[model samples]
Target: MTNTKRKWFIYSLVGIGIILISLLAYCIYLYQVINDSRTSEMDTTKTQLLEQTSYVDIHSIESFHGTNSYHVLEAMNEAGEDKLVFYPLEGEQRQLTVFDMEDMLSKNTLIETWQSSCGSCKLVNVTPALVEGEAYWEITYHDNENNYVMNYHSITDGSLQEQFKYPKMFY
Candidate 1:
């Protein structure tokens, strides 16, 4: 309409744009901060394993957070044997638990055991995990109804220890 009204409208639009840009920048910064903390934890676990155990090499490390925090490293021992190193983050005394991979049930075998009962579910990746100092294989998958599921099975006996399911909220 008038020149003064158009100027006011443009100023309002600029202010809103500035606010949105600031919000986006803050979210990106927050995400980076959280990611850095997790990466640092993984690095600390690797250093601890190398110093405190006979493990000579690490193939991979997976971070797990539940009742407790843990970093599970697929590693090799001084005797050239594949091992799993579990380093717990919470406790008065934190000790590294080194397990022989051969002694534990294989991922394929464990997956087969679960698959037999959940034929219609879709399997996701399985990672080595620890619960209260005991070693377990954590399996993540989507059920037939599209609900997210987590099944923790004992590595020694291949028995299910616990399961957590999260139903999808949005279509």
Candidate 2:
């Protein structure tokens, strides 16, 4: 009877292990589905973007989510001038706006400002964003304490627009 009870306990543990593995697999599947959906939406936008814009070559496309969401495209025009195209996402109450890269404040200047403010922060990315019809450089970084920080600065004038700092939840 004792041997039988031991076998039952082992079986129960194996069953629990299987269940955990299955749950992990399902979670991974869900993450992939969400990521694919996001990329597919951008693919659809690029199709429409080519039709509505005159950019000769599209270098990169990045999605920015904030009070206003947009697909910011870095492209080159006919005269070989680099341009930043702000294509408003569907359901957004905004029109397409494009800017000559030269018209905007340089990324280097934005980084310089970020460094002056937080000398110990480690930068993640400097993304171009369009917010409420205004162009901004969205800076993502990790503070000295490893807190996630997002700083938005006006691309037109190189002034701080907004900032959010998210503290690290775990060591």
Those runs of model 2 whose alpha carbons end farther than 4 Å from true positions after fitting are 92-94, 145-148, 161-171
Question: Model 2 TM-score?
Answer: 0.81
Tens digits of per-residue lDDT for model 1, 4-119: 99999999999999999999999999999999998998988898888877888999998877687778888998889998877888896887777988899998899888899999
Can you write out model 2's per-residue Cα lDDT over 1-171, one digit (the tens) per residue? 999999999999999999999999999999999999999978877777766666667888888877767888888877899989887786655577889998988889889987998899999999998767777899999999999998888888888889999999988
Q: Which number leads on lDDT?
A: 1
Q: What lDDT score goes with residue 115 in model 1?
A: 91
TM-scores for every predicted model:
0.81, 0.81
True-vs-predicted CA distance for residue 111, candidate 2, Å: 2.6
lDDT of 2: 0.86
Every model: Cα RMSD to truth: 2.7, 2.8
TM-score, candidate number 1: 0.81
lDDT of 1 at 73: 85
User: lDDT, candidate 1, residue 9?
Assistant: 97
- lDDT (C-alpha) at residue 164 in model 1: 96
In angstroms, how far off is 86's CA in candidate 2? 1.2
Worst 10 residues of 2 by lDDT: 87-96
